[model samples]
Target chain A: MSVAHWMQYLPIEIYVAWRYMRFNLKQSFIVALAVGIGVSIIIFIPSINLSFFGYFLEKTVESNAHIKVVRELDTEARNRQTLKTLYPDEGRILVSDQSLTRRRDIKAYKNLVSEIMRIDGITTAAPYVSESVIIVRGSQTRTSTMRGILPEAEKNISNIEENIQQGSLDTLSDDQVILGWRLADELGVNVGNRIQLLTNFGKKSLKVSALSNTGIYQQDLSTILVTLDTAQALLNMPNEVTGIGLKVRDMYQAENLARLIARTFDLKTTSWMEDNAVFLDQIRMFRVIIAFISFLIVFAAASSITSILIMVVASKSKDIGILKAMGTPPNAIMRMFLLQAIILSLIGVVAGIGGATFLIELYNATPYSKAETFLGIGRQPVTLNLEYTVYAIFYATLSSILASLIPAWQAGKLDPVEAINQ
Target chain B: MIQTDTILQTIALTKVYEGIQPVYAVRDLDLTIPQGSFMSIIGPSGSGKSTLMNMLGLLDRPSSGSLKYMGEPTETWEEKRRSQFRNEEIGFIFQAHLLLPEFTALENVLIPLQIGRNLSPARIEHAKSLLDRIGLGDRMHHRPPELSGGQNQRVAIARALVNTPSIVFADEPTGALDSTTSRSVYDLMREINREEKVTFVIVTHERELAGKTDRVITLLDGRLQSDEAPKESPS
Candidate 1:
């Protein structure tokens, strides 16, 4: 048939489908509702899980740094490199890669950053410096991971400024430090308070100009941010820095940018995702598990549709025989039933999507107490996102279509003579 | 070569129902009917009259014999070719009338044409003309249940004739109607046969109707008993 003819006759298909639904009202409603419920459950659980994961990822990136590039550990070596050929290999056996500590050339690292910034999409780059330092206020002392950052460069790369719960991020003097809220509470310290920081080299007294809260518990409890120059002086390493972080225009292009930086600079580079592979993999695995469980509901829904269609075919055997005897091809007969299922499924899909959207909106508007963390973060309400809602609709539509196909095919495969006899 | 004079011809046609002991439904029956002829095959139930009609209509295959349409043997015909032959050359009216309850009278008439040929404006016009000829011009929009049994059968007749096939197979076409309606339906069939020059082969146990036909073939069990042409009553 010509496209225009099919278009014109499309209503005939709908009319036929409507008559089927009307004739078999209970069966049609049961099928549609089953599909709708399946769609809702399938979409809701995973979507909520994703939103939580997204929230956690964002909090992690915000609290610590946008990206972290650390030296890869070698379990076989106590030092950075092994000259196995020269030494005939002391054939080292290792317990864990984390047990090794290695040093790299800092000047080569700076050159690496410069090369990375030359890539098309890279806009800003910064270095991070970290060390285990003891916080001493009078007689009280606690160990914390003191992260050294270049204030101006770090500001260009992350939302560090906006995430500051208290005090200004730009207020970085030589003797001033930013203490994470949980860390400061442990030390009984506050903004403008003086505390002594004892590193491997010696002790240095510094004033806390800021107390910031980054929702992550571990980071908030054990972190202290200091400027690179001041941190270099504190650690007795005049110009040494730990790793470089990059900022790109698109977050989706982070992996590509990481690879480009690695190739251009000949340095070990890692994106935020790679730096936390196990955690990301766990999130992905959880989604897959959720999808697998949700598919049971979808499968049940498809089966319901198939059963209903089989019944309809049985009941309408005489109709089919009549049409076929009038010269309706088997395919056209099949399409008619297929279209009926499609119409039923389409209604369920659209209704499910609309219902989900409404629930999500209501959930967004109805504020609930934010979850308390091990860190000293106060309660904050969860937020709704437009992007995730769109994703839910897309997934619901795809699942609905997939669920309806088998039943339609079964209906299509029905023999007109056999059907009429029934 | 096929002569235009002969509308349907069967050669050594047979049908066997398989099981542990196979049942032969029809065996080596050969027949020919000319265009515009009205013929009847009269038999009791299970005498294979329906099976013969099904074979002639391309609805079932002959077990070990061939059916020739015009001149071409149909034993080697593919599914699509058999479908095409059924669409273009054969019309069928069943005992139940078998009108699709979902469609209006006009849409029912258009069904065959729509399946056989993609619907054009001309084809739709042709369907309307057929419905009008069957005296359903006013009730074209009514569904089958809304029409009387006779009216529904008339709609089926319009549907059967929509493609203007050369021959029609009627299996108790008026079986579901009252006696008066049955007579009118038979008269309409005879009128259409005379006017359109379309051959018709009817299957029935009604002897009076059989007596009015040009020829009557009676069957006992699975075999034909007698084949006789009508003679003028002794006057």
Candidate 2:
């Protein structure tokens, strides 16, 4: 029979690569494990960093509205004239003293709040009255931001129920109020303790309903919560709100939604991201640094693979020569070594992802409180991002393929006459 | 004489080791191997008999020569074509047998067929039959390190014939064996040559072994000294 007949079946290159690994099991294990450690580092760093960012952002967004719409400030308004119209001889002034906007409040804001809530991605639209007031509790007086809200609609936007420690937002009434845990501590008051809120417009006695600690230092320090009727009575603005606080599903879309709200209502809008632009920029810089460091680790691991495979080529040169002498094509020789690299990398990537997940799980499982002091977060969240793991697979596989190129070429170019003698 | 039966014919074949001072490995050599002929090339060390064997086996190209295989000039063949022809028509056994240490005796025997891209069950059975014919059928799964020198050489013989090539070159086929093992290996090659009608070209320094061949060619200092038929054949 012709020896060349029925000549299609298996890929000999993979077989050879697999057998070579089986022959030198220890060396193959060490090289693959090195790649595993590198991949694990790539996966571990960014997941933890992003989790930290997520924790901080959660604390940040809860302290205020994602998008707040208010009357435009005179200093910031594009139209300095506050013109009533283009016709001046009509004797119509844009603003006059009594019945004019004293609070600069969004009038008939209930309709505006409902309108804002109907916009896509806007989860909550709660009208609020904010006033600078002096709190007097047995002569321990401090100036604080007194913010009033309709407790029913308010709890949905800021998720105030989760942060309440001493009492609950459910039982809040027009005569009751909540205080920041730190502010309550400074005034030495407890739930149901009566405190006097004195504003230039009026002074009122209110009962402390709840104390909240949102895991944010500034918000916990100086905030004084009140019912909307109480704040409206203090500010002397009835049936009106200073602003509408809008919440969205995605905080990253807050700025765009803020612009949309501004254009729709002809009012000034502020997004939390715009307010914390510098901090977010710093976080972005941190991510870039993390990614760069991961890249360096990948590059170093790939170099080590090249070094180890070159040693393999040196050790197997005689076998390569034998194959060549038997008329195996040079391309097959290259495939054998490249396939060896791919196999090793796959072993490493699986091991790496598994190891990183275990570590992250262990971290999340631990009961620890130091994260609050260190990162200003109640819990240092360590997230497992499969997206970064995909990147890990790509980086590791490509690195191994590239690392094997030179050594595989060297193996393929072996001189049969010279190598067989060795 | 180059006749119709000629399987390998070379004219003025030259191989030079070029360097600071170029050394002539094989120079101005003309040779022809007839089909189904069992022949030996014998010389002392540095006699270039090994180089001549490598060139004839198509493992190495000569610097200047016209090497014709089955009346086709092979000098201008590309690497892929040359490798294909080598896998299809030529077989080789070195002094050490040179089995891949990772593979079993059976797998080593199947290397040539695998190189030819034939892994069919029938070809595998043919490989097994060659191993059985060489009396190493039971040892087919054993690795090279596990087999004795004579056993390994026999396996090499099976490997060379598994492809059923037109010509096979054995370079010091028994150079590492004891006297008894060498005799057995030599007799096995003679048996295969006669039974399979395949041409055998052997390079060795053993005159006792060379004397049993159908013909003997001697080389000295990169030149062919003589070529003549022996008066007696192997019993």
Best by DockQ: 2
Cα lDDT, model 2, residue A103? 37
Worst lDDT window (10 residues) for model 2 chain A?
A94-103
Q: Score the docking of each candidate (DockQ).
A: 0.32, 0.48
For model 2, state the Cα shift of residue A46 in Å. 2.8
Compose the digit string of candidate 2's lDDT tens values, residues B48-141: 9988988887778999978999889989988788777777778888877588888888888887777777777888889888888888888888
Q: In candidate 1, list every pair of residues with a backbone clash.
A: A317-A419, A317-A420, A370-A380
DockQ of 1: 0.32
Which regions of candidate 1 fall more than 4 Å away from where they truly are?
A: A1-34, A66-122, A133-136, A139-147, A163-166, A181-193, A198-205, A215-225, A242-271, A342-348, A369-422, B1-3, B118-126, B230-235
Q: Which lDDT tens digits does candidate 2 get at residues A265-343?
A: 7888999999889889988898788779878988888888899999999988888987887788889999999999999
What TM-score does the predicted chain A of each candidate obtain versus native chain A? 0.76, 0.85
Tens digits of per-residue lDDT, candidate 1, A1-422, equal 23123432443334456767876788888877876776666665655667777666766554443344554323224352454443443444123322443454254457666776787877788887788888899889998888788888888777677657668878788788998888889889998899988887887788999887756677678868888877778788775676777777665567787776556555566777676678789888987787677667766877777777777776777776666555555666667777776777767766766666566666667655665452433333344445444544455455545655565555555554455445
